[model samples]
Target chain A: MLALAFQLARRDLRSRYLGSFSGGAWALLQPLVQLAVYAFVFGYIFRQRLPGADAPGYVPFLVVVMWPWTAFAEAVSRGTTAIQDNASLIGKVALPRAALVLAPVMASFAIHGIGFLGLLLVMLLAGAGLAPAGLALMLPALALLFLFALGLALLLSALQVFVRDIAPALPQILMLWMFLSPVFYGRYVMPEWVRPWFDLNPMTGFAEYLRYALLNMPAPGLRAMACSVGAVVLVLALGLFAFRRLQRHFEDFL
Target chain B: MSVLVEAHGLGKSYPRVFRRSDRFRSLCSLLAGRASGEVTPVLQGIDLCVPRGQSLGLIGDNGAGKSTLLKLLTGVLTPTHGSVRVNGRVGALLELGAGFHPEYTGRDNIAMAATLQGFSADDLAARLADIVAFADIGRYIDEPVKHYSSGMVVRLGFAIVAATRPDLLITDEVLAVGDESFQKKCIRWMEDYLEQGGTLILVSHSMYHIQKLCRQALWLREGRMQASGDVFEVTQAYLAHHERKSAADEARARDLDAVRGLEFHVRAMRVNGEEAETLPAVEQGAALTVEATIASRDGRVPVVNVGFARADGTPVYGVSSDMDGVQPAPLPDGDFRIVLHIAELPLLPASYTIRVHPLDSEGLRLFDTVERTLTVKGRSSESGLVRLAHVWEHAAPLSRSRGE
Candidate 1:
């Protein structure tokens, strides 16, 4: 099953940019361009600043959280349509159906993860006040974020096969979710009452952990960590349950 | 012998989704772990057991659920009732392109298909050259699959399946798309595969191919198994049904009341002591006696002609009483009776019709005709409408094979 998933992911990645002139380079460049646009809008136009004089520049703060968020959002959105997109394949070939959903999530993470690593290396060399050791420290947090995205992906993709409303509505939902979390700004800037509530959104722990690890910022509270971990476990359980239950009937509906 | 495929009471049905709301309703029902409310059953109660090394042909008309059964056996569609158990690796070519991606090159799709068949990268690398050679599509291997002709697609699909060398091969009328040479190559390969104890399930409209490749056959009609047995019997029955169906369509156009007004018309005809329009199936080479009575309105003698034709209206032979220098015996009511008897019927096992026409005494002006359907039943695989008398001379026949 794992080998099948890997093969499908490779195919998905290659076919996505198959006809393009730049080919796979666009996987990294697209994220970079998105980052540049966000940087210009927030860093230059809005002049957004992090709290405290010692806090990292707004661009670095956004950079740390933005890439992981992009990976998560893209993984979920693409994965949601995975089963529907491969309706032809599912009806014709008898293989593990979950591998179809897993492929897109794996491809999204692989592409954005590389872009994130390259940008971090460039920043470290530019003397951007990044904790070089924190790069190593963030590996565990990154792994958890991947599971979180995968959990949601499995759930949404299965639902998309039946409902079909999930895919079209997912972008708006992710945008609202990003705003609710601390992707563009720090939880510290929110009012105190709302700051504590940020713990409920799973992305909060992921964003704050990246900032704390790479930018030498404050760590997420123990309650926030527990909440995010709990959410991931719960979502993973629900997602697996829903996906396994619905996978058998996918061909009938499709 | 070990059984390679077993299916019991297997059936399939599609959810009835006439409206958008029905799809939603079905989704809700399915998610709730309940059966959908409405469905159109396409197949039902199909029981099959194919032992290892057996080649079974699936023969049926269009929309008779042959393709659906193939998909069910291949595990592409889950059975709605009972179960199917296949104890070996199965490779299926269910449709034209075998589910290939149109945008991908043939080489790329080959790799993906091989992976789907559970071949590791190392295994595929070893067989890559063999697959390309078997497909024999030349430079089109590098072109996108959508750009390839339909025949080329089947060639590539069959080549990959051949490379896999699965334990059980299931194909659905895909060979009809290929050109003659490619088709011959596929048949040769399949024959070699079957020779090595491989199991096969084939679907084709061509009975010649079915009889040539399969030893056992199953005939499906309107989603039900019409007959299942030795290849010759089932295929011959399927063909006879079609022939009778077409002949009946033409028979409906001729009204008996209209023919009764003619000056010389056929009054009654009987085949082998049966007077019905469709006589019971007779064994090949059995004696056949055709008797006809013609009515003449002016008390004049009439010529009786007996003609044999395949049910599809292909005339086989015709003989007139006048041509043989014989006259029909006159009855008390001025009608004439003639009997034509064949001591050993030469007709092969298929559906045929015997027509008796009444003509004026000169045998030139035909008045009316009547046809009776005859079905010859046997296990013979001989081709053509009639068997010819021949003898083999100076033939060597002393060799014996170990398996036999």
Candidate 2:
């Protein structure tokens, strides 16, 4: 099953970029451009600054939080429609059903990894000198973000087969979701009443975890990390249950 | 031989949703413990077993659940009830090129499919050359599958399946496509595969191929098994049923035209001066005659036409009284008797139908028709609908060549 999953992901990655002249370089282009836009709008135009952030500039602060955010958002949004798009393969081949959901997540993870490394290189060249301990802390945060996205994707990909509204409505939902999380703006800027609600959004811990790791900001406390992990586990459990139940009739529906 | 597949009481039903909103409603209701749409039951109560090294043929008309049954056996669609236990690995060609990605080249698609079929990377690398040689779609193997013709796509699909070499192979109507040469190549490969102890379940509409390839046959009609037995017996029964159905249809068409408007009516038809209600048997190349008596409403002489047709409704020959410039003779009873004659009928040993058409004076328009089915019995071992008379001559005497 792992072999098949790897093959499908590799094929998807290759074909995705093969259509353009720049090939795999195009995968890095979109995120880099989006990063530039955020830097211009939030850093220069609005002149935004984090209240308790140890980082000096808004662009680095935003990049630290938004890199992982981009991966999470893209994986969930694209993963929702992954099963529906591969209805042909589902109906024809007897494959491990989870492979379809995991392929998009894995592909997005690779692209995001490259973009994050590029940003880190630029930040180091600009002399931020991010600490090694904080850099090591980013690994666990990355894993949590991946787990959350995979869980959401599995649940939604199965539901999207029956309720097609999920696919079309997800991007709009994710847009609202990104705003609710501490993506461009830090949680410190939110009104105190809304600050607690940010903890309820699982992405809050993921974003803060990244910010603390790369910018030496205040780290997510153990309680907040526990809440996030608890939510991720719950979603993962429910997602697997629903996905396994619904996949039995996938061929009929497809 | 061990049994490779055993399916009992298997069934499949698809819910019919007329609108997109209805599908949504059904999904909502299904979660709420209530059913919402009409269900179409496609197959039910199918019991079948295919043993190792034995080929089974699924023969049926369109919408007879043949394809559905194949899908169930291959586990593409879970059955609604009952059990299906298939032993050993299975390779299926359910729909030609169904799993192929349009944007991917044939070579890339092969690797993907082979991996899905449980081939390790090293194993696939080892067998890749054999698959490419079998497909033989040169140059196009590196091109995207969307650019391939339908035949090329089938070649690539079959090649991948063949590379896996599962214990049992299931195919549904995919052979009907592709050029004759490719089809022959596939058949030869299948024959060799069976010889090497591979089980096969083949679904097709062609009886001749089924009889040649399969040891057992299952005939389905309207989601039910019509017959299951040795290949010869089941196929013969199916063919005989088909013949009876077409003959009834021909009879119905004749009866419908007999009462149409009644400007001209055919009273009686006689074969070889002997009147009969049904078709009469005749020897091949024997003298035959068809005499028809017709009654005209205005006492105007009407043209009578005679036609010969094969049992399958293909027109063989037709000649009208007006076409031959022969005028119908008026009888004393206010009717005309038209006679069509043949010194020697040139039909092969098969059943045929002779039809008569009554037209108004000129054969420009037909008013009524009557027909009789004839069985031409003969000792000649000829094939096809008609037998042409010819003498065989030796190009060079066989004895001279042998002596040399």
Candidate 3:
């Protein structure tokens, strides 16, 4: 599965480059620029104080959260349409359909990793140097992030086969998710009572964990972690079932 | 003997249309707990087996389910009702440049395209040089493919595909991918593939290609296999049906002319000849012999002209007696079947129509007219609208025996 995922990732990146002049450098640059903008706005312009944040500045905090959010957002946005975009491939080849969802996940992961490294630098500049303890959580954090994106990608990609609107609607929804998840504001900033309502977001948990683990603060609430894992499994199981149901019908539609 | 692909009772279907925006509908339905609608059948009960080394031709009209069948047999689509079990590796070119990216360089695209076809980086590493050399667009192999000309794009595509050499190669009409030379190269490559015992199934429109390459042909009509057997047998059926349809159209034109009103006092019309006129047989590519006449209503003019037409009411060509650079002298009264003469008639006959119109003095219409047909029948080298004199040669002669 990983081998296939890598092949599809290579194809996915190549197509992004092929279809546009900027190539994949543009993809890497877009998020980098987004980070810079947020840094300018929050770290310099606003210079808002972090209450318990030995975390240095807010944008680096925002960067860590936004990077993963972008991955999840871009994965579902592009991944749902992956099968639709490669209708020629879907129409002609007998491929393991999971590759469609996995391809975008890998591509998003590659770009997001660059943002992660950039976040590391910004945090260091903002007076928060990495601790060995903070570094240890990276893999688990990435895995949880990966699982969350993969599950949603699979579900939306399958639904896209039957209903194409998922491909376009995802980005708008992702933007909505960004504001809701604490990319610009922490979930803790919400009231104690409404915080539970915000915890319904699997991503709210993942982003809070990035803030906590990377900044020497507390991780996302335990309930959010539990719910996020459940959401991944649920999305994956239901996505596969929908994919299996729609798999036989795709050629005719193409 | 190698058996590369087998499909038994394979089928697939799709709903005629879900609204293009059905994603929103599906989301709405999902949130509301409703199931999606049922599917409509597209392919029903198809059984086909392609042995190694044989090229199978699939010919059908649009919507005959040819593309759908190719998808099912190649495993791009699973059968809704049955099974498809393929042996060894399979390559399907259901569409050319299936996963190509416009922004990527040719080399990068090739690497990515091969990987999508289940190739590993190592596999591509081994074949990369050969694929590049085969594509033959120097220097531009590293440039983005969007800059490549259409012809160049096809070269890159065919290069990657030809390098694969799978156990089974299933291709749609996408082989019409390049120029004539490339098309010929593709066919030659397929012939060589067959020579080496690779199995190939091709869906094509060219009867010439089907006859030359396929030992057997499957004819599909409206999504069901109409006939499957020797290539010659099935092609003959397709051609015969086409001829019958055109003939019925010719018969309808003849009946319409019987009721046309012309200013001339009386008579009938037709092109070259059908029910009313016949000419002496001439060599192929000779001018047509013509015949049509009009009786005088009041001796206004002796102007007569005949038009040659195809079965569908289209004129083949026309000429008139009035063009001596001036109208023919006015006619005196006499009932006449005008025998307009030509030295040669250049037509390959299935059926032809001649519309005979009568003009009065000053080239004005005042009375009656007619449209008719000319049916030419005989075994001739010429089969379409035009006839040609051609050469025939035989390499060997065989003796015939009375007893089997």
Candidate 4:
């Protein structure tokens, strides 16, 4: 099943990159360009810093949260119709349904890799040394990212075959989720009254952990990372559960 | 040895029907009383089983639930009613090129296809070369599949599944693809697989292929099993039923035209053409003759026309009495026999209707009615449209040429 997922993901990657200049390079280019403009406008013009200011530079600050957020959103939207988009295959071939859901997740992971490297370079350029603690946490952070993607991918892709409206509705919904995620600023930047709320949010802990990893910052902590991982598992399980329940009806509806 | 697949009361209903009824009902419920309509059931109570190593052929006319049954068997479309169980893995050519990515190379797609069909990474690695060679697109294997032709796509697709070697192979019309040579190759490969103890379940229109391949055949009518038994018996019955229906149709058509005036007109016809003389029933080649008669009017005269239309309205030739009537004389008062002489009939054994028209000397139409179905019952085109004299020769440069 893993081999199938990767193979399908490779097809998607080839399709998106084959005709463009610097094939496969666009994955990094998109996130890098966005980071550069944000860093210049906010850090240079506004003369601002990270929410904690003590943690890292603004470019890394934005990237740490932006990468995972973008990955989550992309996985949900693309994975939404992953099966229906290949309705012939789903209807004709006997393949593991799980692989179809995970295909987009693999593609998103490709982009996340590029975005992460771009963030690392930007942080170094800003005179922030790489954080050892941040490096140590990259593995867990990646697991969390994949977990969140799997959950949303399964839920959205399965429904996409039936509802169809879900694909068009994703961008608007994901846009709302972006602002709500603390990607632009830090959890500390939010009002103290809502600090507890940000802590509870799955996106908040993820951002803090990623930043803490790259800049050698202090502990983003075991409790926060554990909470995010737990939420990831719960979401994935529920999403897959929903997907299987709806899968049998896909052929008629698709 | 064992039942490989079985379906009990398997059923499926497309949502299009329910959505349609919802519209009618919602209208009534909104404006007045509750509305209702019957939902169309696409499949109902389908029960079938194929034991291990058995080759099953499904035969049905269009819209008889054949495709639906195949879909359910392959697990593409789930049954809305009973559960389905299969003991082993299934490889299917359900929709040709279903998993092919237009932008990916043939090699890449082979790996992806194999994996999707349940092969492991190592398994694909081992079968990679064999898959490419089987596709027969030598140098283009590295190119993106979108650049490949439709035939190439099937070659690659068939190659991939053949390599996967699933426990059961379920194929629809994938065999009816590409050129004749490719079809022969695929059939031979399938036969080899069967010899190796692999199972096959096929749905096709080629009665000859099915009769030869399947020991037993199934006949489906309106989503129900009409017959399931020996291939020869079932297929013959199916053909006979259609033939009978067509014959009855021809009879009704003749009756409809029977209402025309026989006096001073063309009456009933047998062959629609008649030769002045008759020939032997058993001869070197079969000859078709059209015979007809015109009732002479007391004062008025008419020149009639005769012609033949191929099975599909293709006009063969037409002869009119217009040229014969240029002297202002009507056809003979009684009957006239027009014979179309042919040493051999070129058409295969199939049904074709004949046409007879009535006209004047100036080619002005008087009356025309098509009648007489000419059924050419022959095994091959050797009993051809025209008789020909020919010889066969073999030449050798070092020796001499000989003709027979």
The number of the candidate with the highest DockQ is 1
List, residue by residue over A150-177, the lDDT tens digit for candidate 2: 9999999988888788988988999898
List the global CA lDDT of all models: 0.88, 0.82, 0.69, 0.68
Error of 4 at A101 (Å): 1.2
How far off is residue B230 in model 1, in Å? 2.2
Q: How many backbone clashes does candidate 4 have?
A: 14
- lDDT: worst 10-residue window of model 1 chain B: B395-404
Q: Evaluated with TM-score, which candidate comes out highest?
A: 1
Which is superior by lDDT, 2 or 3? Answer: 2
Each model's DockQ score: 0.62, 0.38, 0.29, 0.29
In model 4 chain B, the worst 10-residue window by lDDT is B275-284
Give the higher-TM-score candidate: 1 or 2. Answer: 1
Worst 10 residues of 3 chain B by lDDT: B252-261
Measured against the true chain A, the candidates' chain A TM-scores are 0.95, 0.93, 0.86, 0.86
Instruction: Flag regions of model 2 displaced more than 4 Å.
Output: A48-55, A121-126, B19-21, B29-37, B252-404
Give lDDT tens digits, candidate 3, residues B1-404: 56667777877766445566554554445434454345677777778877777678899887899988887777777777778888877777776655666777898888777766778888899999999987888999999887988778878877887898888887888877678887888888877777777777889887677766777788888777888887766765565455546656545333334433334644545344634444332344455544555666454555666676765555677766666444433334454555565555666544555666666655555344465545544334333566555666875655532111
Could you tell me how far off, in angstroms, the CA of residue A201 lies in candidate 1 after the best superposition? 0.4
Task: Give the poorly placed runs of model 4, Cα more than 4 Å off.
Answer: A48-56, A114-127, A213-230, B17-39, B252-404
Model 4 residue B362 CA deviation in Å: 37
